[model samples]
Target: MEHRQLVHFLAVLDSGSLTAAAQRVGLTQQALSKSLSRLENELGGKLFERGTRGMTATRLGESISEYARDIIASAGKLRHTASAALGLERGRLVVGLSPISAASLLGKRLTQFAQNYPNVRIDVEGGIDRDFVAALHRGELDIALSSQVGGQYDGILLEQVFSEPWGVGGCVNNQALQDAQSISDLADGKWIIGRNTDLLDDIIAETFSNAGLPMPKPGIMTTSVLFSLHALSQSDFLAILPQSLCRDFNGILWRDLSDGAWISPIYMMRRRRAHMDELVSVLLRELKG
Candidate 1:
């Protein structure tokens, strides 16, 4: 019923234990229990099932989770709105960046944002696509630059900013590049890639299958772009990368796939109905520029 109860509920849901959630929320176990009890009573439904492992949301709890998150986001936006009205000069924004996008121009972009909004506080975290989208849904991120998202993010809106063909890259001296004119030519080569969600992995597999080649297994899998690039440059792993990198970096060779089947798209995403904080707006504008 109370805002604090929802905060406690979310903390517990995220932490997975009353004890840990209590520690995070600066409350004793007893106090947190009282809050949860009151909330459950007010709603007339059992919210969570407790066990030695941790708390698991009940059916009702799961159904109401999204509404709880929206309420919290709206409350935070109201605070930011009031603060902005007093003097549009102070606010906080957390921005999530995809690894490649983060490494590209994060320093210059953040520097410009800070100069433009000296009173604003900015927190930046780099992550994979799913992690960034999860953070946005949890209300932990105000905006994110990530790969194109899907319906999994029910309340987020996306705008595509950068799109480039994805190509297979490897060390310039790799023997595979010497004979490779198509995906079939590289079938025997080792590949390296970033973390693959089932969706991305399936796409990669289908591309090879459509070419009548067996799916190439990645010899090295990593979440770090630098590591993936290093694997390509130092080893024989053919990696998927933005085609632009081949023009920028030396000692790497990129060749377009025979089918031209892959393109990497970077998107700017935010909560669909939330009010844009001034600081977030400033950074978004700079990114668009």
Candidate 2:
């Protein structure tokens, strides 16, 4: 019921253990338990089911968690606004990044941001775009970088930062696909598709349609990007992926389909109607550069 109780509950959910949560919130285990007990009594339901591995949120807890995060976010924003007005230069920033964009981005700029804002704590969460957007809406993230389909969520405003042109990537040493240049060129080639997300699949379909070719049925499918990359290296299967992903992998060869039009737009998104914090502006400036 109290702000402290909600904070303790969230800590427990995040830490997944009474001892860890207590340590995180700077409270004794007994005290944390008492707070949780009082909260549950007020709410008339158990929040979490404890286990040896960790504490799992109950159905009611799951529903309440989103509101708790929003409350905490609003409180933090207030603190940040007051601190900025006082020239204290301190606040917390949580960012979300999609799976593909997470690794390629946030290298040099992240370090520079850290160096510039020594007092601002930064936390990053990586996942698919759907998960990232959901977290963004729940106020768990201030900024999110993800490949988005044109105009979906009305709650957030998006700015295009980068364009990831889809390419049919193969291994450098794979002689079987040496002649492949476009989707039609890869007709006879084995395809190793990964996670069948809606956006990705749509891009694949559109790419093939643009090339005036039929979509190649995938010979193998899995969710792991590493596994997909490794499969491409070892086999002749061609994968549809961004060129950014292959920059570090030496043996991988990303062949542009000559279809320049099929590029997935990577967007920097934030909640609408929210004032842009100075810290966020700093990060955004770096990203835009």
Candidate 3:
């Protein structure tokens, strides 16, 4: 029930052992045990089952984690709200992104945000959409940018950033492409696909299938955006990229699919709020601006 106990609970869950969690929380082994015991007594159940290797969350502990994180996040938000009322102008925001999407939100905008709100702390982590969405539900991330999303997330909302279709692209100076007038001409070329999920593979399959061609076996499956972009520009892989990038992204040139355009949208994601927080609003504005 106590905030510290919940914090300790999560520490143990994340760290996977009492000794490690105790060390992390700056508590002696005995003190951490007592804290855990007090929390178990309050909740009327054993939260974790201690084992020789480490501690494992009992069913109760596993289930209570989301509620614990929500309570902690709410409490932190309340503190921030009070601070804002006192004109403190201090805040923390966490953002999640896939590497390529950073181009949309980082650079000048990120630098400007840091300069204008030096008191605000920002944490940006790179990951795929599903991981980011789970983090959002756990109160880990403030916002995210993603290319593809599906299924239901309980408290998150998505906003499309663009509706433009991505184009197939190859090295601007690839010798093989000089005689090519359509995607079919490069059907045998090695392609780049996403690594974190099968979504990109499926998209490739569908795009080729729609064009009445067998899918090109992926040459490189990667999550590193820079590598993918570099490979595309440097004559190593054909890729579907942002429309702007397809035309010219450091030597990548757009090539027609010759069947139809392949649309890959970019979206911004955040938690749904009845009343938006001031700092979050500012952050969103900077990202979209």
Best by lDDT: 2
Q: Per-residue lDDT of 1-289 in model 2, one digit per residue for the tens?
A: 6877888888888667899788756799999999999999999999999888889999999999979977866866775576466442677777887766665554446666878878878887766565555556545678888774445676778888876766778899876556665567666778887754466677778777876877887798778888888888887778877777876787898877655755777788887755577777778889777
Clashes of each: 0, 0, 0
Output the lDDT of residue 104, model 1: 48
**Against the true structure, what is each candidate's TM-score?**
0.67, 0.73, 0.68
Best by TM-score: 2
Model 1 TM-score is 0.67
lDDT of 3 by residue, 1-289 (tens): 6888887887788778888778756799899999999999999999999788799999999999989978866865675575456442677767786655665434347668878988878777776677676556545567887775764477789887644455566787876665676667776778886542245456656766776798766788876656877887776577666554454457877655544445556677877752356776776777677
| Model 2 TM-score on a 0 to 1 scale | 0.73
Write down the lDDT that model 2 would get: 0.75
Clashing pairs in 3: none
**By summed lDDT, which 10 consecutive residues of candidate 2 come out lowest?**
79-88
- Pitting candidate 2 against candidate 3, the one with the higher lDDT is 2
